[model samples]
Target: MVLIGICKYSGGGMQLTKNPNSTDGLLDISYIKDLTLLTILNNIQSLFNGKITSHKLISTYKTSTLKINVLDNNKSYIQADGELIGSGDFLVSILPKAINFIIP
Candidate 1:
């Protein structure tokens, strides 16, 4: 799993997934903890350069399923597919090709 943002509860977040093409049947997780502004910028830059997995602050992983236990009093925001969906805990499981793209 890979994480890029903060979880708030744990102070980390998920940036990318298992596969960009959604064909891998696993979730690529990226998480970074205790990142400074410079490190954040560097992470973004490295992601663009396809070197995100090499950063010291970044942790990457691959899994078919995930379970997260969230704190009751904490409020954490999750951004999925460029939209702010909701807050709090997450239990993410990847289903291969469960979605399709529609463009005009």
Candidate 2:
């Protein structure tokens, strides 16, 4: 299976999430202005042993729209924030500054 992680933050390449205490300025939202794509190739051994030797970094995309086309005949599961949203073809779009976060 292929695990693809498309995120707003470029957490220092493969780091994904950034460290709060780090002074690398990775916490800045400048990078979040766009999207970063990472594709990881997973196998049975990699899934069970927690090894990502075959993981591949796809590339960083400047566009806000993403289209995912599943070639499989079977239903493909699509998830967001750990919740299954839908299946099959997915059109992901990013709405910049669309939400107001009231951080306490």
Candidate 3:
């Protein structure tokens, strides 16, 4: 599974999203300053060991916009915020502070 996260909780309580050194929030305006991309391999052994083999592809990248292309012929479903959006290639970008948040 591939996951792009802005801050903690992006993975819904998954240990992969937890960072003790950083503050937990949706955006962590100060803590997590960049978007993180996590790419997981299909190998069960490597995943359990939490190790990165040099032979494998780069697993992470930091960027504002992410472009995904499905090279495989099989149809792949895409989901956003727990909702199924569609299938196929997609580009996702983050607009910094696009919406203002108010606390009561």
Please give, for residues 23-47, the per-residue lDDT of candidate 1 as tens digits.
4456666666676788767566555
| Candidates ranked, most accurate by TM-score first | 1, 3, 2
Best by lDDT: 1
The sequence of per-residue lDDT tens digits that candidate 3 reaches over residues 16-103 is: 2222222222321111222234443344344333333221442444556777787862756777777888888888776766755453
Highest TM-score scorer: 1
Cα lDDT of candidate 2 equals 0.40
TM-score of each: 0.64, 0.42, 0.51
| Clash pairs detected, candidate 2 | none
The regions of model 2 sitting more than 4 angstroms off are 1-62, 73-75, 101-104
Q: Could you give the C-alpha RMSD of every candidate to the true structure, in order shown?
A: 7.0, 10.0, 8.7
Candidate 2 lDDT over residue span 1-104, tens digit each: 22333332222333332222222222211122222333223333432332323234222223355566889838577765657777788776555556544443
Candidate 1, superposed: residue stretches over 4 Å from native: 1-21, 72-75, 97-104
Better of 1 and 2 by lDDT: 1
Candidate 3: deviation at residue 79, Å? 0.8
TM-score of 1: 0.64
Candidate 2 at residue 34, lDDT? 23
Clashes of 2: 0
